[model samples]
Target: MKASALWPMIIILTLIITACSNNDEASEEVDEEDLEETTEITAFMPEHDEMNFEENSFTKLMEDEYNIDFEFETTSWDGTAANERRQISLASGDYPDVYYLIPWVDQFSPSDLIRYGKQGVLLPLNDLIEEHAPNLQAVLDEDEEFRAMATAPDGNIYGVPQLVECFHCTWGNKMWLNTSWLDELDLETPETHEEFKETLMAFRDEDPNGNGEQDEIPLSGSTMTQKESIIPFLMNGFIYDDLETRLLIEDGKVDFAANKEEWRDGLEYIRSLYDEGLIDPGAFTQNADAYMQLGNEEPNILGAAPAVHIQLFTDNDNQYDFDALAPLEGPNAAYSSYTHPIEQGATFALTNKASSAAQIKSIQVLDYMFTEEGSLRAFFGEEGEGWKKPEEGDVAINEDVEPIYVDIPEGEDETLRNDNWAASAQYYHPVEFRDGIVQVEDIYTEEGFERRLQEATYLYEDQEPEDVFPYWGVWYGEDVQDEIAELETNILDNVDQSAVRFITGDLSLEDDWDDYIAGLESLGVERYVEINQDAYDKYLENVE
Candidate 1:
């Protein structure tokens, strides 16, 4: 080979090595810039005591996977204080980039969603749903009921909702009889309303509590929420009592259930129990704490109590003694109080303070929550540590899906195991999703909590009337919202007050019934119905 050729090859090798070194340095510089470019999102949410937000596994996952850090402006779980703080933030224009709310605690009401959305304080999610949230969009598309509830009257989705379709929550007015009392007294479970009345009489007069004194109250409940109210369960035997709405749909028209002839009969029956000292006086006026105290009292003086679930009423060891009574048959009607399965409460809302990048990432974060893996992780926590795949002998609600998971030992502390962000995540555990999960048969311990509820609620299934007024998903327009709200508040307050009076003998059912009806009429109930019916018609148009 020639000397010139060798020299050329050596020069080319040197040039190649130099070029490779420069390329490596450039790549290192780009990596440094990439590391520095992460976006931080600010969020406001109610903080749980068990949650260490900085150390939250879900937050860590999000930061690592998405190159985003969430800085939360939080309030304690106190409902009134949290709400006041949230409102003050809004008024002061110092709110965070996003609001992650617990629907049952301090989330935006549908009316508030509409109001804030229209005022430009809350951003419309239509564009974000179209661009970044395929998971959330899929949910809304598949479930029109959910879509209808989440959407505002002006046809914008102002907030993303917590879509928990807890099957047991659908018929939440079930009465749990102290079957231990029945077993001790040698009484059979009542099948008819009359039989139920006789059993209550026995509980009152016969001293079923074994205390040797007449301390047992035949029936008791609390007025904390309609779910705790006993009237729905007892009155339901006579007429369909839509517990919250107090309205029922028949022949495409909405009518007040409290003023109907069947309602009068139901009230009369409850009055008879009150007159005979069968019903607890505290049941009408007491709060949950007071009611719980009565139930937890020594000697087990309560014969029966109404609640959405026995767990809602008590977590004491005595919760095991109560067994759910099936819907009793009445002469005119036999139905259980039915609530809409879809939870429409807003759990995630984007504020106008969010930057465009923040907006995109916030929606992305929530969209992740709607996925199957995300839902399970947010709800139950990391698999294996918090939950585990079912064994061969384990029973799942649905047998088709693979790798159905059950709660592990750590997941038993349901109140403490999961992170705080899980409570604020937007996700819906629909029937299909919940059905595919594993459920154990044990109800006594915290390990198989869901199993106990599923079994107890089974008795109330298929007992709902076919024509239940779908008031839950209906949205009144801005024009009629105030009028409807004012009217509803007045009417519901009066109805509750009057019911207590009639049940406690402060008012006569036969004489004061017409006046009670007249008072409700005076509260602009006719206009209220008209507004709700219109909203219902509109919702049907959109959903159907």
Candidate 2:
């Protein structure tokens, strides 16, 4: 009785234990499944070769924390191709749930936002931001300019902008003079337009580089963008030349700078430089690479170059040799072309295709990027890996502010790390946040390049006209948007070409200036100004 009963009892107990273990395993599996359940949001983003979204730590963290999965439809990072793909997606009615764009690569313009929002292709983000995005709402509430930019004339928020307060970007049209050449020639830093001209003459004639061949490009720039154009830096000495817009605001009224008498004088001054061989002929036609080649020449042939940053034209070896030249005092007034610190496009947008759940999740994810911790994680990767808290001796970029974080240096050879979403996730980086980052004390060092830019930008700060045109935040009506766009293209093209011709002596400023004005008028310059004036008025109302 004892042996048989004992064996039966032991078997029963073993069977019960195994059943409980099976139940526990089943519970664990169910919990894992629950954890894996995530809202799938299809996103259209610019493809960055250096980043692998699948292996990205930020992507994983967002998926885990927000319980959202991103199915990406990537377009080439090339601006033209990326924009084309974005348009094609919209045109084909196959657009993704959301678009996460990189500002430099490609993003939706205000017109795009307005058009898409009106057509119901893009969802109005006003409600989404109000309900789901506190961090973003705080920014909009705090920064009137940002709010003005984000809001359309119709009072609907169509998309979230990449709010990057880049201080140096505010003064984009800047001239970097070869201080080494000045030292070599024993010439002081030029304070006026005449002085600058004399300095350029010295650079051209005195053999600044010590090369007997006279291979020096006295003043050079690239045609890649208006910021690289030498015209604005020189023309600013006569009139406020914003390079791109060629518009000026006087007494809160939109006015065309190119049509002004001062503009002609500026051109005359520039033409004189061209006549004297002080201005490089290639500056108006060459691309960035060619301009950079001139800058990086072995004997340092570039005497001066106009660029937003020296790094664009010169490498680390020659960057230190150049110094920022403040806006030269002309006959009229000294002025520096001012670009708004905030980028001009919307980087994050929700499409009508997104489900209600997807929209909420997407906004929440975007809102996270507006937060400092989330912003750092989304942009710079996890702390201690991509960045770390500053050490005791670390100095902040803004010296008055305490250093918050220090970036970990990546290897020169390492292109792809698959750690973070590069520039695509940059939603909010305010002045305080950017300036709080640790920078090396030596502004000449590679690690302190940002500080160098900051110092350089200081020289150009407050040098803009008393009432500069607010181009960045102004929104145009759909009725006038297309018309304005057309007129702008034609007028700006003519203005640029005419200016070039006038400078190169192909068109005499005295004879051709009136014809140029007539051509502009035919292209509807007055109409352009009128439309912009209305837009600017609307923008002022919003900001106020």
Candidate 3:
């Protein structure tokens, strides 16, 4: 009772004593507690079906593990206008605490880094990673190109990149034909250019899709989509460096490949096909929607098209209804494919406004996305919680399947029916997560699985050698970006326009061909190549 009554007086006396005394220890303790609190980070990303992983992302797992909180913001993949709205925001200084700008910002720029870093907007991460991060340092140390690409021309790094080894990206234009159609018509896959001509003719005449009327399109494709590569992939095979898929650095300067003479040969092949009714008249004018629609609804209407895999029918993405044939051989007797490297992972840059601790925490959080456990969690989702791990009791899903991830076995492998791709890949998240450890349940329709099996089982004859050519990554100084862009765009426009005229018979390859090459030269084709070559040389020198 005495204590209760005296409590207020005691508290007042204690407060008075605390206020008058030097209470540095208590204040310091309070400050230390505040410093230990988690930092908040916000990231901006362009929207994609794939990009939506952040909410249920691996980063979230890392955040929970490390006690760092990172928030993400996003924008549309493509707007009505082709202009990048995310980039516009970045340039305008409307940056968040962090940005996951894979669409374009992965193409690191020295100028941007200098501008942002000098303004104290982007913190230099070299020290942070050198101390707090070790795995990322291991990646940089092991990969030379990754180092070159990650480091800015100013001798500093501004972003991170993706470095998975992809063998197929370089030589991608090869498409599979419906060999079932060839068999129905008692025809074979084309070998030489002349044979290719005959094959398309038969495809048109044979009505292979089994429709009563002659509505089968012998060959179909688009020049618009990179993956839709019915044109450049084939065209580049014929030309040395034609069809500037993206800018290429040659001996020393920048160049557009589409303007080369071999490109003319490729176009002429297509023109010959077009003139004979073996190609779709709308090959150039058609959009992706139209092409994809035809693939789904009128599977029989299409006899041939451009694609890396049989999935171009994409309707039966998991099915095997279609088969691939090799690219038609050309005049020079050369067959090669130059695959593009998988692009670096998009940027997840720190904002200038982020405090030093915030920046450090932000990168550490990003580093988590690259962790073995983190990548799997972000890419595969919560295992057992979301995915099932493979067991000794069961054949792993991929093993149980016949053809695995488009890599089918030869001879006896085809007859033996195994449903692996469906059981394994199956529109599964994180495609490269391969056959063991984590497993995807084989959950595909019969039609889907069979079609995929059929497609993989079919033979693709005389497939060309894969060419490793130079593809421009954004380690380049922007000194030549404007000109390379201008020249390449103009060359592409002119090439397609002239190609239509030649294919439509309005212009002849023999007559308009020389003029076209000359026109390309006049439009700075040589200059383009020289610029590319120069850039490559400089790029090589810079790497050393």
Candidate 4:
């Protein structure tokens, strides 16, 4: 566990790579299955400015195990720019052997996989997986939903999946109050919708800071992310739980949730708040860096903003202070938390041109990432030496590599070091299983976590809308995908532009609610529902 000992392990691994290629057992015992000479696998990826892939433990271990070297082609995470670049690459026909961590853009994402698979650009992975990847097959058989999602229109498996077991990862839309401001006025944390409004109003008018200046801006955030967006998810308490960008399966339809009557109700409440000067005027216009500046100033000026957690608003320390408030209980006496699936993004894919060994082995590599042993090694580095498994019930931190870069100020660069050679890798394990090794105590105090538990505990009772119509919850075929995509886009866009208009009082809910519902109808909500029903029916039939 000391720094000096890691060098020996590195030396041994390098020797294995040089002498026997990847695996010692395969080197000695295997001849008929030996891969032909010089199998070059090239990988395409988004930019990892700080990561040095050559020195990564995961890479080092895999290369030694499989004797396969990877060449990576990468880009920064700009979707429009990446898509344009990809089109050029496709046109040029100079593609890499693999694509890793490609994001989901409207035109470029789902369609790309289908298009590429048909063009013979991607290999069918199911039979290869059955032959070469027992671990992956275990996950596929165990989670039929995941298997269903992994298959394409032609019923071929073309890509690997990204899976994580972080239950708390679906960040609830939470309101964080500055306890300092509340104490100055001697107010309890607001519990219900009415109290929340009054509290923001008090922050705006009372000039809670006796400094005789009305500089306090109540309710602020940027367009950075959905949970952090100023107007969308937070407004769910007042309305039909319509979030401006919330995507969900509702009534067996792939329609955007924002077009519902609940959205209009939510917008009306926001309009009222803005009219009373309770919501910050700058929130809509401000950039994230500017917004964060207001949050992190020596004396923070923010009051009652919507955020995922207090950490996003301020640091762990109470210096730039903020506090958690439970999700508001609305007029309907309803409180709910919305979420997508547990998994977040795609990690990688193999090509049709690659050897069968490469295709199956890629899945095997990914499968390892999902295991406690493999995920820990993939993210945290080697187990017995690189990281010390924390004692039961005790969450610990690697003094070597902290998750956040305290090494730099906000907006500065984050440097990643190689765990195989240096100290540790930044990622590891299913987060819940990270209990003994990663502490919530340092991040959230026992008191604060307990309070959060109390808040979301009651709110978790509301099940997902997709779950009620369970059949609509899985993957759709080619025709259904096209119909759903068109309907979802129109529905979301119409609601977003209108909801913002309604909240700014540029449009009125009283006058426009009927028109909005009609517009959603015109955009094809019914057909959207039917596509979902058909897909769900097929998925159910397959299972039965």
Candidate 5:
């Protein structure tokens, strides 16, 4: 061979040697111990538009800890069109491996969960929780009521429900009176129906706003939320108005309150208020935005408003003037509406398409979120940047549980905070856990938000009657689920329309009362009662 041929061979050999050396060096750079084999999981979640899940601290922490990469499908926080999207995904059979939802937004109702679970579209979590999720299992072991609510009639937990034991949320339909107006008029908080009536009358008559004009609303409510509606609080003073079920359990039997004479008397009382222009005319149809405008606008046009929390309608300086009104004594009865404190329906679930490994990873991530450290991080954000550990002498809402941390910037925008998970994950903060946390010292600051709420809610707590219905935890069996749903839809619609008609004088309460009762009976109110009674009995039996 010539020297030129030898030169070409030598060049090729040197290039090959260099390539091999570089490859070996690259291989050596990877540390076996540090290498993580990540599993990719797809999830559909509900989120506020401001939240960026990719940059969320909770998501980052979970991904890092579990060695899993997440592909997220996030919908608007309000979830207005999210359900339609979810349904389409379900129908297309292109659903993600997991769903992380906020119940108030788009989430699986118990009926939906049961149906999808039975169809094998959702995976049962009982065995998975036991095998892979010790934290969730521990929660179940500690709270039997939670386990009962989570379990289906078929004896399987198809989805994970959020156990938010919010103390203030249980009796969310209390009224708030502007004490400044009352004091200016030399009136005390009304305790009786007649006294309350007189007070509203005075508010309407007197120019309480000091504008020297009849701009004061006197008494107002919105149809926005049950808490904002005046009917639940006022009507409850007349009968056991379980706001959710709209049916009360009396003498261990289910009874429809809307058709009862007490309910009629309550309507008549409310009608009198409407007739005299005490309640806001727009309260019957206006949304939260309009209702909030009544309280939040300058010059303070509202005299009194019905709400679970004043924050629902007003915030900042506008909220300070209001205080919770005690349940009024009515002709028939006097009681505040009570609710059991468990958010029903499924907030998180694994789809059938998830592989066994993916399922394990999913459960592990959720379990971590349920932990004390993880719960705080998931909700408030990372300790130092998002919040700070409590120092000595810091006061807690309750002294029984040790103080955890106080918020730093306090009330920063969700977009700027690490607590992007919000209600998307399982965050269990029982009364003790919550009360033990350091509260904001300043009532006006963002850190003081929870404390202020706690103080205001304290006045309304324990006002529930002994026999308030536990509708929050009940699940209608599969046999009557569809029927119950249909009946409720029709009955509630009829009742709501009739209530408005009676109040606004669209229908004569005296003349239309019998027809209204008849209408309900025609709509199968009897069967509705029977079905619920059966469910209630079954619920009691199971819980007992």
Candidate 6:
């Protein structure tokens, strides 16, 4: 009886233990399934040739790590059409849950953020960022300019702005001279306004290209943007031509640069060049394609062209022949147009349509981009495929900085790797991170173009006026935004048109100078300055 009882008791105890173990295993399986649950987010972004979000390595990694699924609605990288599509989506109330934009391609302007934020179309990101984005918050806390640019007048963050501290981009208006031609003619790089003029004369008179056709364009530019304009590079020698703003700050007071006597003098100098046929008449009227044609012509007819980089004007074959010209010194000043590297627009935004879970996950995804590891992966792609750790003897772009990463060049046969998001994922890239990229020792090659730009930028660095206005951080109140925008358009247009007319002899500088000044006054130039001054004051308060 004792043996049978002991056997029955032992069997019952063993069954109970096995049941408990099975229950524990079932609980573990349920927990694993819960962990695998994913949040779905719909995003609107621009389509890029280098990336397919569906197959992107970074995208897949984010999906697995954050337990999120991304569905994208993309427009082509054509800026105008992309902007139109984004606006149409907003207008039709068919917008996506989130908008992941590329700053260069298209993004919401400050005014657009204000409008949509107030309308409740774009969700306020202040609470989300504070709670879910420690990396982004650290940046906002440290960089005053970034904080100012990201925050609206109402002290609410509607979106996350991209902070790419690109060194070469700061000095956008640069004059790229044909150094090959200079060497051929045995001339030195121009250092002063007079020397620059003399150099252009030689380019016009001498056969520097050696084709002997006398078809050389001594100096040329385009009407595409201020960076392409021949006027800013030359005008900066006489007056601080900030190009787009035409605003100058002196003794903390805002004034117009285009209305000064120095501006008239600059026009006279340009007029002399036009009269002598040294200045290309096409420069004042040609678009970028037409302007590029002058540079890409056989035997390289262009002696000098105004652009941010040589690649903008000439293809790779002729890019090496040109080099950046330092800001020319004039009687009044020597200045280069400087735009802060932090872009003005917001690149990532969450709309009201997104679910709460989606918003949190989306922000978490963006927050990762602010970290060094995440930034490299999101921007450059997976390790060894898009980029790799720097090898021995590899030099960083900034010589002082230690090398962190080197890009893997794409094979000639492969057009698109579909590996990284390209520029769309650029949420945070500070100076140290950008400068830490490895570069080849030979800076003249295509792969070392970044180094070339870096060296060129050094020449123009610190050339801007000490008290130059910070345009990127300013935010106008809704009440004055439209008024100032209107005034800006009218005033800038008149200034551009009148300057061309004066230089081309369509309007005599002696006779039409007063009329041009009067025209600016008629266009509410004073009012524009007053509003900008107010904005600047407010911007100072916000940043400081």
Q: Report, for all candidates in order, the number of backbone clashes.
A: 0, 0, 41, 3, 0, 0
What is the per-residue lDDT of model 2 for residues 1-544, given as tens digits with 9 covering 90 to 100? 6897786566445434433333332222223444346878898888687777877788888888878888889877899999889876776566788999998888899988887776666778887798779999998999999999999888999887898888888899889999999999889999999999899999988998886988887998889899999999888888898766889888888899999899999999999999999988998899988877888888888888999999899884888899999999899889899889886669899876676667777898899999989888888888888899998888998888988789887888967667788788888888889888888878899989999998899999989888878888888898997898899899999989888999999999878788888888888999999999998889889989
> Tens digit of lDDT per residue, candidate 3, span 1-544?
6988886566445434433332232122223344367766676654543334345445556566655676656565454321255545444555566665543323334455554554445555676678656767776677566666666666666666555433333445556576777788888667777876687788777667776788888778765555465665455457543234434444444545565566667777777677677878767667777777767664467777776555555565422445556555567544445543445323545555565556666666556555655444444445444344444444333454432222222254433222111111111112133333322334244323433332332232224333323443444456776787788688777776776787778888777777877898888877666665665665566556
Off by over 4 Å in 5: 1-37, 398-401, 409-415, 418-420, 441-447
Q: Candidate 4, after superposition: displacement of residue 332 in Å?
A: 2.3
lDDT of each: 0.79, 0.85, 0.55, 0.57, 0.79, 0.86
lDDT of 6 by residue, 95-184 (tens): 788888988889999998887777667778887898889999999999888999999999999887898998888898999998998999
Name the lDDT value of residue 90 in candidate 2: 71
**Candidate 4 per-residue C-alpha lDDT over 1-544 given as tens digits, one digit per residue, 9 for 90 to 100:** 8878886566445433432322232123323355433345676665555667666767778777766676767665677776676655554456565665633431224455665665556556777678667767887787676666566657777665554433333445556677788988888888776787888888877777666778888788766555666664455565434232353455544444566556566777778888887777666666667766767755456787666555565553542356556566665434344543333223456654455555545555566565666655665556554455554454233323333211111233634545432211221233344322443444346333533433433344352333333422255666566777877678766766676677777877888788878887898766766676676666665554
Quick one: ranking by TM-score, best first?
Answer: 6, 2, 1, 5, 4, 3
TM-score for each prediction?
0.89, 0.92, 0.74, 0.77, 0.89, 0.92
Q: Model 2: number of clashes?
A: 0
Candidate 2, which segments miss by more than 4 Å at Cα? 1-37
Badly placed stretches (over 4 Å) of model 3 are 1-35, 46-60, 76-85, 102-120, 164-170, 241-260, 314-319, 333-336, 393-469, 542-544
**lDDT digits (tens) for residues 152-174 of candidate 5:** 87888988888777767777887
Where does candidate 4 stray beyond 4 Å?
A: 1-32, 35-38, 76-87, 102-108, 238-260, 315-320, 341-345, 383-386, 396-415, 420-431, 434-437, 440-476, 480-483, 535-544
Residue 443 C-alpha lDDT in model 4: 33
TM-score for predicted model 5 compared with the true structure:
0.89
Best by lDDT: 6
